[model samples]
Target chain A: MGTARANWAFLLGYRFYVAAFFVFLAAPLIAAGSFAFNDSLFPALPWQGFTLDWFFNDTEPKLGMFHDRRLLRGLYYSFVIACGVSALSVFVGTCNAFLFVRTDLPAKNFFYIVMIVPLVIPGVILGISILAMASQFANGLEEAHGIELGFLRPGLPLVVLGQFSFIATITSLVITARLRKFDATMEEAAYNLGASRLRVLTTITLPFLRPAMIAAGIVAFLVSFENFNTTLFLVGSESPLTITMFDRMAKVGSTPVLNAVSFFLMIGSGALALVSVLVQRDRTKV
Target chain B: MSQRDIKRLTLFLLFAPFALWILLLIVLPHIGMGYLALREKIGPRQYEFGFGNFVEFAMEPIYWNTLLRTGSMSLLVTALALIVGFPIAYYIAKIANYRTRGAMFLLCLIPLWVSDLIRAFGWILLLRETGVISSSLQAIGLIDAPVELLYNDVTVVIGLVYTVMLFMIVPLVSTLDGMDNSMIEAGYNLGGSGLTVLRRIIIPYAMPGIVSGCIIVFMLTAGSYLTPILLGGKNSSWFTEMIYEQFITRYNWEAGATFGFLLLAFTSLVVWLGLKLSRQTLAGTVARS
Candidate 1:
């Protein structure tokens, strides 16, 4: 009876710890989501009466949120850049994974180390390096050919390039983790039965890699979207969503509009998480 | 086609994209950065080949101080993460029931799914004056006034640890999951106390994971710019901040490239040493496991 009582006591203590951990993790997100509906100008202290003014109403001069055209543009730019970076990274990363796992490439280990170097290198450094190279290229182009490439002039293309530089590494790692489990004998047998390499890859290997590829692509998009260090250096006058939000917080303190944006992002990410979980479940069952 | 020809062609096709990516993105930029680092800035847009940039970095006390501070802060954060994260990982991996373990693991991962910007902002909300921590303290009469918590090293360290804890925990859990339970039981059965069993059996078994986790956390915290930028404020300057200023405000590419290379070299050296040590320790643990 004493041992049973002691076990119960221990279980209760552990349950409390777990509860605290969950609360700590979830409280901020909940708070941020709730604040989106707040009518207050400042996000700091006293909560003024609840209103959906930030999301819907635009009657007030300084208060209404949807009137902020800057935020809308930033969001649009972020989506476009994220989509581009994701597509490019998925293509390059998938090819890299195939090479690493399935092919007989010489100096595989050496290339693997080189590939992962970007992961260890800081984003700020990568950003500056790319900026320097692009600026130099632009200067040389002006001097030699008397032409200007506006896209590469520390804005959209540069941001995409900076993001893709490292995001591809992440995608490659994820796909490679999945590929390590692949049975290559299937591909070998397909080849022996007169199926070409391209057909075997398309039908067998590509199908196997689809889930990991999707996950990697989503992760790459999110990483590029949320990136600040690299994007900050490369972003000219125009801002990405994260950069815009950060600039607002720095200059004029936090606003309910920021909270509204956070709320929208939270919902988007949560939906993505739900879909990924369902997809993973289906894949596991298959 | 012959088998050899087919194999060669297949290898070329497989490696083509990756080779191009590495060549264009990684190799070419580093080569450019290296050249820029060696050249002296004659003016805003002009350069001449020299080691003046390296000399400038070497001569600057502020640069060295920032580097030292960044290293020490990273070390402090990495140590804190290991201390806090190891127990949770051990519990999830070895003690918890299967159902509970999944939930607990998810708890650890929730912080990771949130953006770092949001997480840092959350810390500000909790730590700033009239924020949650201060308000609660004031309500409890623990202090007469709300304390200033932002724009300091304490907040920076807290932010770093909060952001990087999962990096340490995930690797440790993966490593601990592979450990056998019977060895720990045997230690306890042979007149060993709980502490002895933990210290003698479990920790040694889990050392590789711990080491790898520490290395990863250390490298990440050392290079991280956003957490420090947001939480550290203007007064608390990290080395990366200097690089940012050079590249952005001053447009000093030479100096920025030099700083970047120096930071890269430092991280790579630490990684090399860590790999060497972990390989030796891991060999022993692998034999035992």
Candidate 2:
């Protein structure tokens, strides 16, 4: 009876500790969510009255977030750049994963390490390096050929390219992890049964890799969208949402509009993550 | 040519995109950065080949001080993470029921689902003088006044630890999960106390996870710009801040590249040493396991 009581006490203690940890992890997110609906402009002390004014009401200072053209433009730019980065990364990462796992590539270890180099190197460094190279290339082109590539001059393309340097590494690692677990015997058997490599790959390997591809693509999009260090160097005059938000915070004090934006993003990302988790669970069950 | 040669050629062709991308986008640019770092910043628009930039970085007391600060900060964060993460990892791996373990693991990973920006923002909210933590502490009379918590080195350390803790935890969890629980039981059965069993069996078993975790957390904390930028404020600056100023504000690409290369070189050297140390520790753990 004493031992049973002791076990119960231990279990209760463990449960409390676990709960505390969860609360610690979740508190910031919850606070941000609450502050989004807060009536006050500043994140001042004492709980202000609740209002959806930041989200819906359009006025001079708090320009109804829905109608805020600058914020919308920033969001649009962020989405477009993220999409470009994700697509490029997925393409290159998938190909790299295929080469690493399924193909007979010479000096595989060297390539693998080379592929992961960008990940270890700081983002700020990568950003500056890419910018320097691009500027030099642009200068030489203009001097020699009298040709202009306005898009390449520290804008969306540069942002996508800079982001791709790291995003591709992430995608490659994820797809590679998935690929390592894949049973290659099926592909071998298919080839042995007189199937062409292309057919075997397309019908078998591609389908098998599709889930990882999607996950990698989504993660790449998120990384690019939220990316600051590299994007700061390559954004030029245009701004992504994160950059816009950061600039606003730096210039002025905190605003409820920023909170509203963050809250909406949190909800949106949470929903997407939930869906992905469900899909992953279903896949595992299958 | 044989069929094998054709297959190898096909594979090489398949890998062409990655090779080209890495060679041009990463390797070439890094080499260029290294070269730029050695050059002199002649003007806002010009650079001449010299070692003046390196000399400038070396001569600056602030540079060395920031480097030391960043290194020590990373080390402290790694140690804090190990303390917080190990018990949780141990509990999940060895003690918890299967369902509970899964749930606990997911709980740990939830923080990672949020972007680092949002996470840092969360800390900003919590650690601000008029923020939740201070308010609660004040309300509870823990202090006479709301303390200056944000924009300090302590806050920076907390933010770094919170941000990089999961990096330590996940690797540790994976390593510890692979460990056999019966070893601990055997140690205990041989008249060893719980502390002895833990020290003799569990610590050695989890050493790889701990080492790898420390390396990853240290590297991440050292290289991290966002957490330090947001939380550390202007007064408490890291080396990366200097790099940012050179690149963004001054437009001194040569100096910026030089600083970046120096930071990279230092971090790479540390990581290389960490890898060697961890390999030895991991081997010892494996032998014991």
Candidate 3:
């Protein structure tokens, strides 16, 4: 696979590029996490004698983020939204997968292309568009029924919906990747045995799709949990963890405790990602 | 019900809910945004449709310059992601064995799970005036004082390149993993040079993935608001930031809607051009990924 004399220069250059890429990928995460243990107020270098003060100190100078009620509450809101979005996106995205991969519809590609429009559209456009649409719809409902539907305005439900608009699209694509590889002969065999459509859908298609749904569920939850640009304008009185963290970092001049939060978050997502990988690998093995 | 009717009903039921959802949320909202983009508000509760919004964008150099800057910057981000990501994908797919390939593939993916906001903050920790880079240099007596490394285009480019590289790599890995390695070996057996084999065999095979990755990365980078805002600071001239300002800060929905459509248009045009040049179908590229 190489010249008689190995191109040591190229090999070294290639290895260097890969090593540099890995550092580029992992440095910020490692840096952010390392500074969390620093006892200094700022997260810069010259690690001021290591301490767990950021995680537990409740004193005036640097308060432990773990004991912070506001952050925890924001975390709570994010959890709720993530869970709600997971449920919604799973149901909707699974149905979307079935629609694209299973059904016999004219202009199927058109539907798929339209569905994919969201993936490329930025969160800003979706946020403003959803805001404008919801406000308009709420106005119409108010004018027509003399009812103020505050739910249409902004909240967790709206956040979930806004996130779902694209999350579900992504989910469907994930499941469709599986669906395309699926052997339809199983479904045909079930039908040949006089199994009803409902029974076949439940017994054959649903069973086969279970793993994909699980994978998509994890992604849906992660996407919903970390979402910011779309969730920012859509969440009302209840801001999610990302928004709170953004406010603290960009606006309030946050402490190194924010670094501590980033540390915990990196560890947490790493664990969840590990779980997702296991689930995916498990499906392949099965 | 008749068997055919029941079958048709089942199909319809299976598709209708998602169809209606997309119609309501994804499609109509854009239509609303488009309608808003075309109109101008003359007075309170009074509106008129015109090309004034587009004209305003053209009349203002700052608006157009920001648009052009965002275009070039996003293109740079896309190109850098492709350049940085291709080798990693090749390493994961071709060099790594079955046991390690999956693990290496997930390495590129792990960053995505971390939120973009935090990722940007991480860079700020390292690149800000009193940040790690400055402090380390100062420690080594490279410079006497903390240097201003933040609030610049370089920071924004680094942040965006990091943000979108995963999008590029994932598709590349998937596409390359599916490729038969024997083909590359055959090219070698025929005495083709390494660069010749890559240009003729691998690049052609990976075009769909390459194009799809570019489309996704470019769109995400261009539409991105948080990373540029955080890393590039107050003067960061991302077009999405402009759209956000028009809609949120200035309360000008019409102008904001126009910018939103313009952003969408620019991204779609880039994607379309990429697809055309690569001779790839959208469905084929997305399906491959």
Across A152-245, the per-residue lDDT of candidate 1 in tens digits comes to: 6888888998999988988998888778878888888898899976799799889988888888888888788778878988898778898998
Model 2 C-alpha lDDT per residue in residues A167-247, reported as the tens digit of each score: 898888888877887887888899899999689979998888888888888778777877888888898777988888887
**Where is the poorest 10-residue window by lDDT in model 1 chain A?**
A57-66
Listed in order, each prediction's TM-score against the native is 0.91, 0.91, 0.96
lDDT of each: 0.79, 0.79, 0.86
Give stretches of model 1 more than 4 Å off: A1-21, A61-65, A188-196, B43-46, B280-289
Specify the poorest-scoring 10-residue window by lDDT in model 2 chain A. A277-286
DockQ (Cα-based) per candidate?
0.44, 0.48, 0.74
User: Model 1, A188: alpha-carbon shift in Å?
Assistant: 5.3
Model 3 segments beyond 4 Å from truth?
A: A1-3, A185-200
Better of 1 and 2 by DockQ: 2
lDDT score, residue B267, model 2?
81
Report i-RMS for every model: 3.5, 3.5, 1.2
Shift of residue A244 alpha carbon in model 2, Å: 1.0
Among these predictions, the greatest DockQ belongs to 3
Better structure of 1 and 3 per DockQ: 3
After TM-score superposition, the amount by which residue B17's alpha carbon in candidate 2 deviates from its true location, in angstroms, is 1.5
